[model samples]
Target: MDGDDRAGGLTRRRRWPWVVLVLAVVVAVVVAVLFLANDREPEAAPQPADPEVVTLPVPTPTIDPIDVEPGTRFFESLPRTVLEYALTESTADQAAVASGAVEAYRLVLGDGGTTEVVVLASQWRDADAAGAAFDELLAAEAAAAGIPVDQVGTPTGSADDAAAGEQTQDPAAPTEEPTEPAAPTEPTLEQGPVEVDGTQVGRYLLVTRPDGSGTVHWTNGTALLRLDGPATAVRDVYAAFPL
Candidate 1:
């Protein structure tokens, strides 16, 4: 009986070591799986892409004001700055009296005196005198250009006449319904009857000189004006001029 008991004890002890080894292997597998799961980073939540950026444009200012004291009423009424040009000088010229003008004024305007514009304004006794003077000036300019006076510009109806429409009907004819007047066409550079704000103000003449500079002449009421500057700059100044 003793020998049988000793053999059973040895078998039970060997079975215990096998069971312990199996438990150890199971624990090692569980720890390895836990470590691997902790090491793996979670997928970053899908980030929304940055919104696209857009840009817009800026507008330019038309008028630029400056500080200056205009000596005469005519000069005082004039704008200090016409677009980019500034009025830099104003003077009453007695020499202009020789030309039959009651009052003659000269204005010097420029972009820092780099691009210059010289304005000569003269007031006359009456509309007839002004008209005659304008004709003489036109003739002089035409002769300087070596062209006929008519070629300079053909006289067109005033802005008032144009806006009202010309009406001519025979006295014997029956009256009909009046129709809407057609829109007045805008005049271009070197064109007759210069207009401002859709109204014919005066006749325009551009005279190119031997040099790059040029002269622009126009009449307003009892006053005649002449502007001299670089050809391109003079055009801009004339367009920007209020009177």
Candidate 2:
């Protein structure tokens, strides 16, 4: 029995090379199968990006920075001498575009009650300039309304005039100057243009007439130039502002 076992061990040693070759062939076959299974069509090419949209800015006359509540006594009780009104903020921090330190404006005309003439702006030098522009605009619009610019009663120098004229029994009465310094008053919004800092981006809706359409313009914090005419109709003239 011992001799027979010895012969079997010798025979198995001689066949080892054949066994290794068979194992190698089996591995190769499996790898080929896997490779074929994983083979697939090439991926499609990436699509190109779309072109950017371009829009041109439209300009118009500037207005005061103030919010107007519709159908209110403030709207109905507007002075006849006042064509429009606004209460612009001294600083953009208190304005709609305060986040950008940009100037803003709103207008309310004297129709049956108050018709918002035009309100759009979002860039300026400072709030004081905005207030100044409001005064100027009020004066201009009043002049257009056949009232003398001097009699527009701009709330200049002191802010108390805003309260004096606003809460007074007479909206047409001249505002008395304040005797003592008071805390800065919130801007009073009347329908008209508001001033801005020397360095401001102003766009406006320049209404030629209450019945007729108006033009729009842009300002480099200086001159007001017409950027759009009757052919260019826009809902919000300031929508075309780049700022």
Best by TM-score: 1
TM-scores of the candidates are 0.54, 0.22
lDDT of 1 by residue, 5-104 (tens): 9999999988998999999999999999999999999999999999988764322224344566545575666666666777677778676668888888
The per-model lDDT (C-alpha) reads 0.72, 0.44
Range of the 10 consecutive residues with the lowest summed lDDT in candidate 1:
56-65
- Where is model 2 more than 4 Å wrong at Cα? 14-18, 37-39, 42-115, 118-243
lDDT of 1 at 71: 58
Give the lDDT of residue 31 in candidate 1: 100
Off by over 4 Å in 1: 1-72, 153-191, 196-199
- Candidate 2 yields a Cα-based lDDT of 0.44
Model 2 weakest lDDT span, ten residues long = 223-232
| Predictions: Cα RMSD each | 18.0, 21.2
Q: How far is candidate 1 from the true structure (C-alpha RMSD, Å)?
A: 18.0
